[model samples]
Target: MPDADRPQELPARLLTDPEMINACRLRDFARVFRLVKTKAGIYPSMIARRCELTPSRVGEVIAGRRHLLHMDVIERIADGLRIPGHMLGLARRSWETPQALVVTEREAQQPSEPEETPSSLPGPDVDSILAVATRTSLSPATLEAFRSSIEDYWRRDNQHGGEPLRPAIVGQLRHVVELLKEDRPPSIQHGLYGIAAELARLTGWTYFDARQYNQARAYFTEALHLAKEIDDRQFMANVLACMSLQATYQDKPADSLALVTAAQDQARSAIGTTPRVLSMLSMREAFAHATLGSQARTHEAIKEAHRQFERIGQDDPDPAWVSYFDEPKLIVDTGIAHGRLGEAATAEPLIADALRREDHSNQRGRAFHAFWLARTQLDQGKLDQACHTATQALQPASAVASERVSGHLKEFYDQLAPHRQEPVALAFEARLREALPLVSGSTRP
Candidate 1:
C-alpha cells in the first residue's frame, strides 16, 4: 500500500475525501489504469511485479481506494505502465478533486424547445460549384478531369499569388461537407470528405503560416476528426502531427511530446508503411527532447528520423504528405533542434547545408531556415551576423505566417537585448519590435 503522507508518486488525487470522490466520479483512477494497461499490456500480477508493489496494492488502486496516498507508488505504476507523466497527472487531478460545476437555478432555466430533426441540418447549397460538378450536364469523366485541372491550378497558383482563390475554394469545400452531412452516396461522400479534409488542411496551413496558431489548431482538429470519420488513417496521422507542431510552437514541449506519441501510435496502426509518418514522429521526438534540454535523447531521435527518411523511395512511399519530407527540409529541422539544444558548432554546418539547398520558391522553408541560422549565430556570439540574418529572416516571416517561427524570432531578439547598443543589435531590435506586435497581439507602440 502507498504511504498516506507522501503523495508525490501517486496519481494527482488530493488527500481529502471530497477530492477522492470527485476523482472517483470522473473515473480518473479507472482511466489511468486502463491507459497503463493499454500502453504496457501488463496483467495485474505483472504490473505489481514491475512496480515492486504487493499485488493487493495494485488491485486496490485498480479498484479505487480513496486512501491510497502513495504518489510515488502511483508514479512507479505509471512508469511500469509506460503511461506518460502528463496524462498520469491529469488522471490524478481529475480523480482527486471535484471539477468546478456550473450551477443554474431552476427559476433561471427556460423550458426546452423541441429538438430539430435531421432534415434541419444545413444541406449542400446545390446552386454552388460542387452541385455543378455533381448534377451538371458534364459526364463523370469530364467532371473528374475538371476537378483535377482545378487542383493543379490551385497548387500552381498557391506557389505564386493564390491568396484570392482561398475564399472560393473554402466555399466549394463547405458545400461538399454539407452534401456529405445530407447522406450523399457512400462513395461520393467519401470523395467529398477527402476534398473537405484537404481544404481544411490548406486553411490550417495558411493560418499556421500567418502565425495564427489557435485558428490553425481549430482547422487541423476539424480535419483530423473528419479524416477519422472517413477512416483515413494517413490523413488522421498528418493532422495529429500538425497538432504536435502547434503544441511545440506554443512552448508546451511536454504536451507536444504527448501529442506526437499519440500520433505515432495512430500512424503505426495505419495500413502499410509511411516513411513520412515515421519521419514526422522522429522529428517531433527530437525537437521535443531538444526543448526539454535532453541532448542525448535529441541526438537519438534525430538519428531515427534520418533512418526513416532514408527508407523513402519513389515507389515505396505514400505520396500524400511524403513530398514535404525531403532531405533539405529534414536537415533544416535537425539543425533547428540542435541549435535549440545549444549545439552551435554542430548546428551551424547543418544550417549552412540547408540554406544552400533552399530555393526561393519555398518561402515558408526559407523563412524557417533563416531564423534557425540567425539563432545559431546569436548563440555562437556572432552578434553582427545574427542581427543581419535576423533581418533577412524577418522579411519573409510575415509572408509565411508561422507562430513557431515568430516565437523563435522573439527569443532570438530577447537574447540580443544585452548587446542593444551595437548597430546590428539595434537593427534587429527595431525589426523585432515592429514584427512582434503583428504576431504576438501586443498593441504597445
Candidate 2:
C-alpha cells in the first residue's frame, strides 16, 4: 500500500517520461538517480527526502553499492516519485494522470471486445521508426544473434529477476519488429517474424513475472499476431498457453481452462510439434482444473500430461522454448497444482525434491518452490516447520525482483496471521517485517 498522507501534487518530471520509466523498470537506479540530478536538476538528498530513504542508502544505491529489491522500498519509491503502480508492480499510487496519457490495468480490466488485438493496446509506435537511407539485410547470423540474446536474457531472468531485464527485452522486441520493415529474401522473412514472435513472448513473460498484467497482455497479443503471420502453429499454441497461465494467476480459472483447451487444439493441428509441447499444454490444463477445485478433472489432466510427457523423445523436433519443460519442471508444477487443491501430502515431497535439485543461483526459483513447500507444510498443520521454511525463503525472496515471490511471501504472512500471538509466529512476523514492512496508512498523493 502507498502512503495516503503524502503530498497530493506530483513532481513534473516523474516516470511519466518513457526513458525514466524504462530505467526504473530496468532497476538502473544509478543511471536514473544521476539523470534526475543532472537532467532534472533534483539532488540526491532531495530524492532521499522525497522517497523516505536515507540519503546514504540512496547514495549507495545510486553508486551501485546497494539495490532496490524489497517491495516496501519499491512501494516507497512509487509513492515518492509519483511512479504509476502499473509500472512498479504495486497497487495504484494515489496520483492522477492525464486521461489521454494512460489507461491503467484497473481501468482496463474488461477488454472492449471478446478478442483484444495488439493494435487495441497503447504501445511503442511502430509507424514512427527512424527513417534510414537504406535497410540492412536480414541474415541467418542476425537471427541467431537475436535468439542468443533472448536466451541469455531468459537465463538472467531465472537467476536475477524479470524486472531488471524487462526494458532490455522490450528493446529487443522493438528492434526485431523494426527489422521486419526491411526488404528481405522470401525465406528469411518468415524467420524474422519467428524471431520477433519469440522476442515478444519473452518480453510478455518478463512483464508477467513482474505482475504487470496489462503490459504482459499487450506483448502476448503482439506475439500471437506475429506467430500467426508466419503460420507457425506450434509457436501460436505456445503463446496461447502462456496467456492461459497469465489468466490463471489473475484468478480467472474458467478463462485459463478455455485458453489451454484452445492451445491444445492448436497443438494438435500443428504439423511438427512434439509430445513435449503437448505435455506442457496438458499440465497447464491441470493447473486450471486445480484452480477451479475440480479434483477429478485435475487428476485426469495431470495423468494425461504425464502420458504425453513420457512419449517425448531425445530426437523429438521440439522447439528450444519448450525445452525448459523437463522432468524437474513437471514435478514442481504438478506439486503446485496439487497444493492448490489442498493435497499437501501429495505435493510436499515433490516440491521438496524439486527444491533440493534447484539451482542456487536461481534465487527467484528457489524462493518460489520454498514458498510452495511452506504452503504445503502450513496446510498439513506443520506450523513450526512452515514458519522456519518460510523464514529461509525470506532472504532469497527479498533479493529477487519478482512480484510473484513477494505475493507468495505475503500469503505466507497471512497464513500465519491466526498464530500471531504465539512466540514462534511473533518471531516469524518480526523477520518478515524486517524483510517487508507493511507500511500503514496512505500518503496524500
Instruction: Count clashing pairs, candidate 2.
Output: 11
lDDT of 1 by residue, 149-193 (tens): 446644543343334344565555555555554655566667666
lDDT at 186, model 1: 67
CA lDDT for candidate 2: 0.78
Candidate 1 lDDT trough over 10 residues, lowest sum: 105-114
Q: Could you tell me the lDDT of residue 389 within candidate 1?
A: 83
Clash count of each predicted structure = 13, 11
lDDT of 2 at 213: 83
Give residue 356's lDDT in candidate 1 (0 to 100).
88
**Top candidate when judged by TM-score against the true structure:** 2
Q: How much lDDT does each candidate structure score?
A: 0.64, 0.78
